[model samples]
Target: MPSPTMVASFRMLSSQRPFLRHIRHTPHWPGKWPTVSHARQLTTGSRELEGDSPQPERPKRRQKLRKIRTLDPTKLSPRDYVDFSMLRQPNVELVAQSSDLNDASNALLGRLSATINARGIRDGKFPPNTAGFLYYHTPPYSPPLAGEVRFRITPSPDTASLSEGNDLLTEYGIPWKIPLLHMTDKKGYTGLQTLLLRDGLVTPQLLDIATSISKSVKTLSRIVGGA
Candidate 1:
């Protein structure tokens, strides 16, 4: 038979067995109970990782674009300045006395004067009422005139005047044999009448009266400012 002291000791050990199994089965440190210092170190490491966690990346700031300054063409030097007067003027009178004048202006004046003198053109006028004229930045508007075709003129090829003039002749169905002007007779004024008739430039009855006047006049010299 067992004594009372042995029985009491066995009962106490049985009660502690469950507590020992619970400690062994805890998942915190696998099979071991965590020490106070080690638990504190783990807690501190977790806090550090949280503190060092990367925040959401901020968006990059866009750089501002540079502002470009606009240049005024008129504000430039006189030679470089673009003259807008040609757009408004029906007839531009050019004098090459000033060196500051643009090249086109000077060239037009010289060329037109030379052409007029060479052709014995008394009045700075050609047949069909066309005359050489200048533009803002361009050479003389060849076939150059400020009449009906002045505003219609644009920058064209080197032979544009000749070509357009030919086209105009074709449009009017005028034969090439008719001289542009007559040095002696009134054929040029008569041709002008023909052109005016074809293009309907003026009323028919009025043109007929003008034609009669042109025929009655002895020479174009008086009309063209020549004695």
Candidate 2:
């Protein structure tokens, strides 16, 4: 067994060992020591305020798009991607509604312009009475005629003007041809009539006309000024 003095001496040295080791190993920073960093990411505003080590620059926020990218055309919205109001409706008809005589004249020209009618299909030509004039239909009214509709303002080419001149042209209809559906008669006008009939567009009026050509002539005359 060791003496009490020696035992006391050993305990004293053992206690001092830890203290000496800590003094020798204590870390010393050469410059100002750093403070605790934030647990969350810091932004430019935060860096300015906190004065801590700079965080990695935050990725820029994504930008928005004018239009969505998609394979489906039906999903597209025309109003968004395009300048909707900026588009021109050149093919659409514009006319004065107050002109009764002008409107009547246009109606007659339209009837004459019929290439496919109750009578059948004719050579797609405007009649001789309509020769000097040209006709156009408002796209909205002329197409897929869900019900009866009116013709557009007739284009009268001035006789004083030519295609080369503005003054010499005076026809109300165009020289260019437009394909239109017409009616039929008992005689059954042309193959186009059969096609339209097969397609079921030769409405009840034409069937009546076919059943009674002379009888329906009055209805025709009333509508077109002559059978």
Candidate 3:
């Protein structure tokens, strides 16, 4: 019973109501969209995580190596120090003196004098037959002397006389002398005698003689020098 215009208007209104209902059920519909509570919670959780995280610091570089320190020789103590003036010489005579003497004289002279004083022979002591004497000159050349020279004088007779004295000679007689003959007797014979007896081959007797000579030399050295 409705009029034609009214019927048309009612049809249009019905279509618009269905469309609005569809829009209201959709998630992104502006008029009836869902609340953003879950999204906001996720955003807040991300922000809190970012705030709790710590940033890593960078590592530092290593320093260069330093040079090693060295000890100075001048600051070090001397190995040997001796007083030559305090030393005593028995048969040695001081003939000449060095003008260019240095502080090292004590070390040099003390050592040399000690070596000589310990090896010197007392009065009335005969020189060993196996003993040999070596004389050295100022030029410092050792000239060979007879083993029987009966003195083991150092610095040479002429040179020693010019530089020092016969005191060394008097203290320790010639290197080679009749006194060493007794040592040979104790060992039963000389090296030459043992060699000749053995037909040029070294024999036990020769070895024994050598050993005895070595012992004798050691004894003499010990007696002459406290060392």
Candidate 4:
């Protein structure tokens, strides 16, 4: 019951199959089909080209070190050395036996060493030896060589200096002791040695001389009294 036109169309399509098949089998790239060896060579060539191409250089990695903050000895609390060992002379052998004590000692020493190197001695450098018997030594403690000796070190500003009401001399005009200079009767005292004991002027050198003089005076007094 097929229509004449439909039947004719179907026959035309069937007749074109062989032509289509020939077209499909023909190489579309204008060459014969590649053999197994030719295919291998093509793949190897592509690989070689890839290998020969310049590669991007990787960036060098650097190790970042952590910067440690230094500890301030002045800021250290008394509790830090509460049960801590480390004491004077002949008993020096008994120092830093415990792990806590040892760690504390090492930390203290390291900080002290760094501090001394930074600003301890004269411009962080030792003085040149004048005498033949000058001792190059380090003390167990570093005290303020100049200025008034203070037992307590705190970050808080001195309240006495800050207080306006504390200035009694300014308000009441109170009398204060002043430094005195004693002169010998001799007109030209070439052998006279002057010493200053003001809080600002007193130094270790002056202190040592004063101590020796005091001892000598006491010894002389004792001898004279016995006579």
As for candidate 1, its clashing pairs are: 131-144, 141-144
Worst 10 residues of 2 by lDDT: 82-91
Candidates' TM-scores? 0.19, 0.19, 0.16, 0.19
Q: Evaluate all candidate structures by whole-model CA lDDT and list the values in order.
A: 0.35, 0.33, 0.35, 0.31
Task: Show the lowest summed lDDT stretch of 10 residues, model 4.
Answer: 83-92
Clashes of 4: 0
Candidate numbers sorted by lDDT from highest down: 3, 1, 2, 4
Error of 4 at 168 (Å): 48
Candidate 3 TM-score over all chains jointly: 0.16
Residue-wise lDDT of candidate 4 within 32-146, one digit each (tens)? 6778998898899999988997889999874322111111223222222211011111000111112454455434332221001111222333222210110011124633222
As for TM-score, the candidate ahead, 1 or 4, is: 1
lDDT of 1: 0.35
The residue-level lDDT of candidate 2 at 166 comes to: 18
Off by over 4 Å in 4: 1-3, 28-52, 65-227
Better of 1 and 3 by TM-score: 1
User: Tens digit of lDDT per residue, candidate 3, span 1-227?
Assistant: 99999999999999899888888777655564336986687689899998897778788864322110111111111211111222322122111122455644323333221112223445334333312222211112522111111223323323323223232344434332322223243433232222222232233554456557767777998899985
